[model samples]
Target: MNFGFLKIAAAIPEIEVADCRHNTAEMEKLLREACQRGVSVIAFPELSVTGYTCGDLFGQPVLLAEAEKTFGELMERTADCPAVAVAGLPVAVDGRLYNAAAVFCRGKLLGIVPKTYLPNYNEYYEVRWFASGDELKTDTVTLCGQTVPVSSKLLFRSGEVCLGIELCEDLWVPVPPSSLQAVHGANVLVNLSASNEMVGKHDYLRDLVRQQSARTVSAYLYASAGCGESTTDVVFAGNGLIAENGVLLEEAERFVPGSRLVCCDIDIERLAALRRKTNTFAYAGPSPAFRSVAFDLPAYGRSYPLLRHYNPTPFVPSDDDGKHRRCEEIFDIQCTGLARRIRHTGARTAVIGISGGLDSTLALLVAVRTFDLLGLPRKRILGVTMPGFGTTDRTYDNAMGLMRALGVEIRETDIRAACLQHFADIGLEADDRSVTYENAQARERTQILMDLANRSGGMVVGTGDLSELALGWATYNGDHMSMYGVNCSIPKTLVRHLVGWIAATHADEATRPWLLDIIDTPISPELLPADERGDIAQRTEDLVGPYELHDFFLYHFMRFGVPPDKLFFIARHAFGERYAPETIKKWLVVFLRRFFAQQFKRSAMPDGPKVGSVSLSPRGDWRMPSDASAALWIAQAEAIRTDEP
Candidate 1:
């Protein structure tokens, strides 16, 4: 399936000043090339037919006549191409000339959008030759023996993609015509621009396109004038940009010597989903003055190669600089939240359970930072290591080492004896490692921590991460219950990175190695005993599937509300090299089942600061009924064929 993706392009063609014939030929060449590559809509630079630098020649009847004839001929030549084309030219209506972009498909003129804003400044004198399209007296313009709708409020629609056009200086104005077009149901906005290159103008121009796409929640395609334009006063770099919902998908290298095009696929469905989720985008109804032009394109029912990149680890940054920055920011948020809670409650001590696993290590680090921020002694933060039936010596030693290095008061309490007593009281066999047997140990550890906190007039800091909460991987009222959850919204994949950041940036020489070793250790609750080699026997990933997959599923599902089949499709693309299709499908099923079945846990989850877009805080970002059925979601997931290409 095409999966709601629409391929769009920004074509920058070589041209000569006032050479309509040569310019039209060059545009046709790039048009056909882009169509062959499956582009559904392609846009060209402003006034491309007669060149933006034609200057006073724009008023010459000969140049205007030739531009119209040549553009008509160009359309006729590319009539067989499937892609809809938007090209800039000067249009004459009611005895006045206006800068405009013509939209056409299959040799037919769809509409003409006049430039609403004309620049009359230091480097520009557009008012000398052409009138602002906003002042046009007629709604229809006759060009090349054809009459078409002419207005600044026209939108062209083809299947799921809707096109809106603005020319040259329109985008630089306070209120671009494309903004209204978007609010009137335009999903794709195209700007045919002839902006000249200035030292710092390129970066500012990119920012404009990016921010506009984000604000309108639409796909934006920008095509600018190239090197062939008149260089008498300024240079045109022929910049082409394609952005979707705040992200710049493709940016052509500026100042290239030849004709080139930048193309990428935009997720139309995702944009629609975001618009619907945000709700405010639909509040303003379509204006009565706006008109919709309908056209046809090739069917997008079949699958094609995707040009977009899907980061497999969405929660974790893919670059080192971004990763370090994100880790530091998240650490600050965690520490800030913890510090506020300690101050508000006036708790004399900050009590935390220090397991050698990733979550507890991060929670401990945040507590230490919070204590330092509050100017409280490290000894006031109690670090308890409760060794249960499954705790190994490696985790125990690392826990002790980290606590001591951080100058926190370390306390060790063996929970195996209490768990065995509880099993005896319940008349259950200690050898049976079932849920009851495992949960007894967890409850015992929590009880000890709570008693310790009560004795010291402190609060127990929870260490369960977001991934565990999503999968319902914690024992309810056991590790899942706490006064405040510092690591509650942090996902497992990010927890490791935060700890690693501390080890690299903040850890002392004595503490860095212990933090690094804790990161290297496998993630587990250590609820079950060690194996024959005294290593962890119950690997969490082996039982509940990889934390990486679960985190990926949670981020997309919650953030974008992507349904199961599409999620599977993108997951396959994102991790195709690292994981087999069957493996991803298997764990996807597990993630869905657990996520739905575990809403009860999240419904009663402890209060924690929401640090990201995807959070399960019942009182804040997410709120779902505890008994919501997963039947429909599971059915959709199960219907996907792993063998399909």
Candidate 2:
């Protein structure tokens, strides 16, 4: 019941028709096993105690008696365990039977949620034996030995988790009960189902659960009856699923020999954050007042074994096929945006600075692709290489080679002399190397590009990536300012992959070696003087931090709006083996300070297409004050100092 995490389980227990005693025993066995695995909330299939295919046997007095006795015993079994369990059964009240899910915690019955919609067409006739929840005479019904609230408006709460119960057919309705429950403050929804196996039915069922969870922005747990039921009319293949916000976290294998139990850890904090960010989710309308049942469940502390998979590189997909599709889509967006700018502005040439780095290389590729799409001459693309004091032979030669191989109009300008002259004019010594010395070179190169674009009747394509913008790594009014920034929304880590994809798929044989070599080269701004060996002397990572860590921090903080404490916790789990906790904590502090202090830079950023969920474009996605204080974020991060490495 922690705010950040809730461990849930979906169980399918083997059952015999009209054999409530044996079914209850089997359910207790599975429940104990799941609880031992640290599952806090467990949901079983619909009519799991009496079987959904009991048919006319559902009305037999003996079967009804056995179900009531078994339900009481099941409630007692949960008394010794801290886990809350939801099991389906038939509840009789006022001369009519209702299909309901009995929810209990510890030794008390929480409530009974009656099935609102019953399927009565085509091999299904629940209306023949049971009644829908719409015709309730009273709000309370006798369950086990105590009277509990029985209505469609009952919500159960245990600590920070709020749960709403729905049956099988309820999810397939035009508007689901879970939707209203979510709007009324339910963060978790559990469904008890007995859907029969059929061709293509599983896909629709899966999509239904996913779409419902996504629409409500809640965590959904679904459990269905399995092979132990009477398969007289339809085969019951036990299927269990656990999903959070449209993403399937865990699902059990269908048509297995025995009862299946699948468990996952859902992030309740993320759900809450999403709801708070969405205006419609908060201001939809006034919902009906419902009964709230509070129960006690053991609290999971700050740390626990994670059942959900945390991708180390959330910005980059792991699958090759997904990566391919993503790369294609991103390229399409970049090229399309550049083409529109070109056509709208009536520019004939595209001038891009070629530094032989990943960002510049990607920018150049996009420029060439846009020209091709617009049916412009390749020679109309002006590729400029301004070799400065720190430019090494590896990068310089790669730049020249790529420009020649791409068959673009190439231009070269040496800015060392211009920067030296500027330093002399400013009364600064060349021997005294400092920030001024570095920035002078960057500004000189940008001046050359701007001038070249003006002389050639073209536009300057910016190469600084989203990571640089986020950390304020770019020189203001130097490389950071441009007419158009193609890589403005791409992070540094993903820029490498995009370049690799182009080299492997788009580059010719003559250009492939140069592209690969550029990728193999180290990332540097090349602002200072080169080493005696004519190699790159200043590494970006050594000065700031790892781009991987920075990208991870940026994604979770901005995309999910996760606070610093939870972000640090998740990062520790995602990169514990690769990076030390102290190292991560240190850079996390740097990231927070820089992100807050550099809003003014992002505020004036050039227009670029957003290709992913996270974008810091001021006019599009993120808007913040330039002078906002980082005191709260910094204080939260500083409090997390630990002795562990």
Candidate 3:
């Protein structure tokens, strides 16, 4: 098994109450199937050997003995399966029986991790038939054909991954054993649960898994007992989930026997780097206060098809209902923020520059929304289309038409002569195309917009987005400075899709046709003149690659602090034949370099609404040094590019 990657699965197989033979046989089928599918680690539901709803049958001497015997047979059947399997049963230890996960691999029983907490309240009366790990006396027990360590402190170690397993009530306690297991050197966590379904309980379960993964910064695998159990008192609704860091990879439907097996290659190298970067994560290894066990898997060089979930558009909400909800909430945030600012400043009108581009279009829409909220005249929203040296007729015409149709005060101010005068004032040669040449035009436009706002007693709304801030793509004192930024938290990738949503659902046919056409247009600033082909020039992706890819890199790297090598691995799987490695590598290097260099810009950003979790606003999420070095990250990325995989 490769340490950098290993496939893990959380399976919720059908179970039979008080039927060890039937349950073990069914589990064996799923176990062998998972191995054939190339899963290296597989976890089944809690108490699957005898079932979670066994009630008084759990204490029956005949049932316990039969379960123990069947557990031994399961070990032999999955001997050469090549997957570490975890199944739960009750083991008699000292004077009490303990709820335990019997970990088996390579024709031998590795260990038994007992449940740390026994729930006695609500629908759970686990204390009736089980004892907590704290009450255990012996550390080793003889079962089957070998002597194995049976304790809650046991951590199973393979060459590829280090794992710790916990049971149902163990995770619900305030101090979960999983947290200590993570601190004692476990990189991946598994939970075998038999939690009963209740109204609104699924939400809490999801949040718990997400929080645990985030708290430990490790891959989490959780498998819950399914519907085929003794429902005499409470029903088991088969909840299963797989999460990495805090993002949910897959979640199973409750009460349905989908036999969920969610698999993803956990990035061990990235976990190591995150632990290295954060000083708070403590490592252990002096004394044996915590027990340890080690096992080796058979040769794990077998190839497995990619199983990681890929959200083609990670920024856009995937569910139709979720997308609608987010759009409505985002509109409200922008509208309320702008409305409050306008009211406090006593500005009766709002002025915005319109380029018919996605960013400005979004800003103008927000302005209209704010005016609508204030019960003011739609004509108070003044939109100006300023044609310049590189202005194209398509964008200019669309910009004018959109403004006129919105019933706003539409104005036109050709800035070609005004920009030339500004260039002379700055002693910059107009023929010499450089930052000065490009930024002079931007500052001139900003000046006109700002002056128009003052003349109309309105506020000039900003439109630069989150991606631009991360890349430092905005001109200083030009597009960078404004009274308020309406689309600051939205990424460039999402902006396109959000505007697409409007075109499809909100705008009329007249506006919808032009919006779709603009969506097809090449993403550009239109700063440079058109080519001899009479088409718009100055494509942005030609200089800075696709924003979609860069935003992916940004979300993973900046949000999770994932290492470059692992990030490269994930991208290779996610993008497959869509992009050449050289192209992805080129843009990855650009993203790293610009992300590090652009911190100074984000550190001084003006007040803006944080509608997403990965915002760079100083008061919110990200906090990085203005001059942090990218040398190590660049080196790692270059090494990946050079590696002969």
**Relative to the true structure, how large is the alpha-carbon lDDT of every model?**
0.89, 0.89, 0.81
The deviation in Å at residue 585 for candidate 3 is 1.7
CA displacement after TM-score superposition, residue 492 of candidate 1 (Å): 1.4
Best TM-score goes to which candidate? 1
Off by over 4 Å in 1: 283-288
The residue pairs found clashing in candidate 2 are none
Kindly give the stretch of ten consecutive residues in candidate 3 with the minimal lDDT sum. 281-290
User: Candidate 2, 604: how far from true, in Å?
Assistant: 1.8
- Lowest lDDT sum, 10 consecutive residues, model 1, at 280-289
Worst 10 residues of 2 by lDDT: 297-306
Q: For residues 1-645, could you state the per-residue lDDT of candidate 3 as single tens digits?
A: 543666788887787788899888888888888887778788888888998888888878999899989989988887878788888888888768888898988678889899988988877788899889878888898777678998888898876478989997788889788888888778889999988888898899999998888788788889999868767777788887888777687777777864556566666666666666667877534434678888775455636666766664567788999898888888788889989989999986788888878888888878887888799998998798888777788888778777776778997898889988877887888687787777877888889999999999988888899899888888888888678888888889988887888888778866787777767777777777778776788888888888988888877776567777766766766777788777778888888888898888788777778787678887777888899998999999887753435
Identify the superior model by lDDT, candidate 1 or candidate 3.
1
Predicted structure 1: lDDT = 0.89
In model 3, residue pairs whose N, Cα or C atoms come closer than 3 Å (at least 3 residues apart or on different chains), thus clashing, are none
Deviation of model 1 at 152, angstroms: 0.6
Candidate 3 global TM-score: 0.84
